[model samples]
Target: MAVDPSDKKALNIAMRQKLFAVATSRDVAAFEELFRYYGPRVRAYMAKLSRDGQFAEELMQETMVAVWNKAAQYSPDKGNVSTWIFTIARNQRIDHWRKANRPDFDPNDPAFVPAEIKPADAAFDMNEDADRLHRAMETLPPEQLELLRLSFFEEASHGTISEKLGLPLGTVKSRIRLAFAKLRTALEDRS
Candidate 1:
């Protein structure tokens, strides 16, 4: 007797459910699948939010490690896997920001902290929607993300960016507003 493709799909779904269970129960193979599917995208998102390539890489690795440790708590019905994972990545980014403010550290002292290390395969997937959001940043005309990156990322005053970019204050404000609106629409269309 030959097996039907729909039967195969049913089996696959069952297998995925079982995998999710095993993943929740600390099985390494299941964990590896989750990492393979989501890791690069998470890294890309963190990379975009960081100060530079190295810091972003470190934060991305930290985010994935947290995902591994926290996988057991994931609730499939609560949300899709990507959103839940992105939440974890965002929280880690916030934590990195808070930690950046420590006072009076000596690199040679025993109390001094070591620099963060990035994952060996921290390179992002060339094309995940989440990853594209990072690259889609570049899709916006340079003047646009620049104004918006400064406005949101650096919290620079419009006046400040206007001075830096040599544009009229009104033009800077309009471009940032339009850039954000377009990005929102594009992401919504994808979702």
Candidate 2:
């Protein structure tokens, strides 16, 4: 049970011989040796693929069963034992994936919820507020308006707006701040 995993050549030779013993004589002891050596490894591999420990454990069981049933078919000339075993594990995962029963989508899920409907009067007030904001924006000097438009509507940073408009960075920040103040005051007065 204390295999020096680092001594892979020895392990492979042992596995080959044990597998041959299992194949030729149905030696349960030889099969048990192979299982002890490779069981946890195959389970770990299935865990990574399935992301579910119990399901991975199940897949590992299926894979080992396959290894047992197909032991006689193995050929050292074809490939090593580990590759053959892992290949069986991979196929078991794929087979389970193909038949997995995913839960039905929840209709009441928050992501699927429709937005709340607005009352008629509240909708009208929102439109009026938008109009008032638009008029306040129209009152801004073209330069300040352009800076605000580039900064917000275009989602450009103050530094980017400064570069695009060829204005000092400080000036761009100041004008956007001033534009917000002017709009706020104008909209307040209108209301």
The models' CA-based lDDT, in order, is 0.72, 0.89
- Per-model TM against the reference: 0.42, 0.51
lDDT by residue (tens digit), candidate 1, 142-178: 8887787898889999999989889999998899888
Residue 56 deviation, candidate 2, in Å? 0.8
Q: Per-residue CA lDDT of candidate 2, range 96-188, in tens?
A: 877776667899998899989999999999999999999999999999899888888999998898888899999888988999999999999
> Best-fitting candidate, measured by TM-score?
2
- Shift of residue 166 alpha carbon in model 2, Å: 69
Model 2: weakest 10-residue lDDT segment is: 95-104
lDDT of 2 at 16: 90
Question: Residue 31's C-alpha lDDT in candidate 1?
Answer: 59
- Candidate 1 lowest-lDDT run of ten: 1-10
